[model samples]
Target: MELSQNKRVADMNYFELIAWLGIGSSHPGGFPATKQNLAVLQILPDEYVLDAGCGSGLTACYLAKTIGCKVMGIDINSQMIEKARTRAEKEGVSHLVEFNIANVYDLPFPDNKFDIVIGESITVFLDKVKVYREFFRVLKPEGRIADLEMALLKELPVNLRHQMEDCFGAGTNPLSFEEWHNCLAEAGFQDVEIKNPQALKDNGNIVMNELKKDWVLIKDLTNKIKRQPTLLPRLQKNAGFMKRNRSYFGFGLIYGRKPTPVKLGFKDWVRQVIFRKKTNSSK
Candidate 1:
């Protein structure tokens, strides 16, 4: 199924391509960054963890194996869910990690079931406020949330933002670091922290290193692109733009906690009403 109608290239299945290329940890800082952020979660062995938008199940498998926690990995793409299931079996963690095809905006689980809800490179493609609210709804009280998302180092010009949206396809909204903090806070999360604020350019070489490790797949793709010449120049153009504007793109690992609901005062209620209006206007 098509991931989005806004995706420019009809033939390109982004998630499938990533899985086929065997790029296990395709996020900003890869598995090492994942480990770093997850460390602060303090997940116990008996915990139930929700891996929202869990692509390929790599991180979920790691959590199951290391922490021995029960994890449920959900992705909207059925192909990704299949791959995740296969990956879990291969990693001998299927017993601990389960894969499901579901939407993030409406999670299948009941309220207050999970001890932790975590996602890597996932939230940028979603309705952040809606998804975060869903996460908050399903999380146990004081449950931890760990999310790594793409962020804009600084605001971009209109043309540049359009260029990025075209290159990355639809659902490419990225918030600034402060915006992210405010978003989490507004979503009922407390003690929100943006950690390890490294520029995307700083990790260029690391991504290159991953590309080198998957050179064989790259070679195969190069040949396939040769057969379909239409795809090559578009890919090249996007790559070139990314290289040119690397400094503007960055990612952040954010952590927050689910706090007990407090009655809002008149001022707080008015601020929330205004914030919701502004959010709708931005959309």
Candidate 2:
């Protein structure tokens, strides 16, 4: 690997990755009520928590230190994982937390393994359906899933969707609000519920305000996407609508749980196989 000029490489995947979350709500439709929302899910000592896509691993360290629980953090970015591990050591929670490099699409664990699974703003990086299915596989009975995702209130305009590539830098996978519910339901999650960021105005403002400096970058990217004939129309139409009414009908912070094994059908097996990817790796 080569050295980076910055603390992290400006690669699409790691660009502003840790800084955004570590600094506070860098995600679009950012964390709604942050700690309060996370508290509702509840994490206690002795629990085995999985922090998927744990970017810089700060959250995992927090879980380990604060809750006195063992936290396993996984991400596809090895550099991110390495940084997380070093941070854990610096914070002196290295023993309670383990950081690893792994793909969400291919989790290296068995059925019914985790007590809690928390994914914060990492959903955009994955195939959602596949991740949810895999989420089910590794979760223990009644295991909780807390997700911080950006959900569109309506279909994104072509312009916005086209610029998604630029905004994310890394390839991003997006799903509408309905798509999130359907996928969670399809994954055998029970008592699924969702909360929108707009519903929590103060938090939304905090997120947008923290991102003021980013406005220039966002504006530039939008302008670039707007000039492209193939993309301008949708951004003008679909994505524009969300941006305009984001204060009202923007993004959502959702949480769900995997229920105990339910009666299965032939089709169910197929669904499981679709999301399940066998991997031979370890913490």
Tens digits of per-residue lDDT, candidate 2, 1-283, equal: 2234343223413234333222234455343344555577678897899988786675677677778899999877666676687778888898899988788888999989999898877777667778888988999989988777766656656675556655454456556777777888887888888754443233323323443433222343444344433333432333444454564334565667787767779998887776564332321
| Sequence-dependent TM-score of model 1 | 0.79
- lDDT of model 2 at position 45: 90
- Our tally of clashes for model 1 stands at 0
> Residue 36 lDDT in model 2?
55
What would the C-alpha RMSD of candidate 1 be, to one decimal place?
Answer: 7.0
Q: Which candidate number maximizes TM-score? A: 1
Error of 1 at 281 (Å): 31
Candidate 1 residues lying further than 4 Å off, grouped into runs, are 2-10, 13-24, 202-237, 261-283
Pairs with steric clashes in candidate 2: 157-234, 157-238, 157-239, 158-234, 159-234, 159-235, 160-235
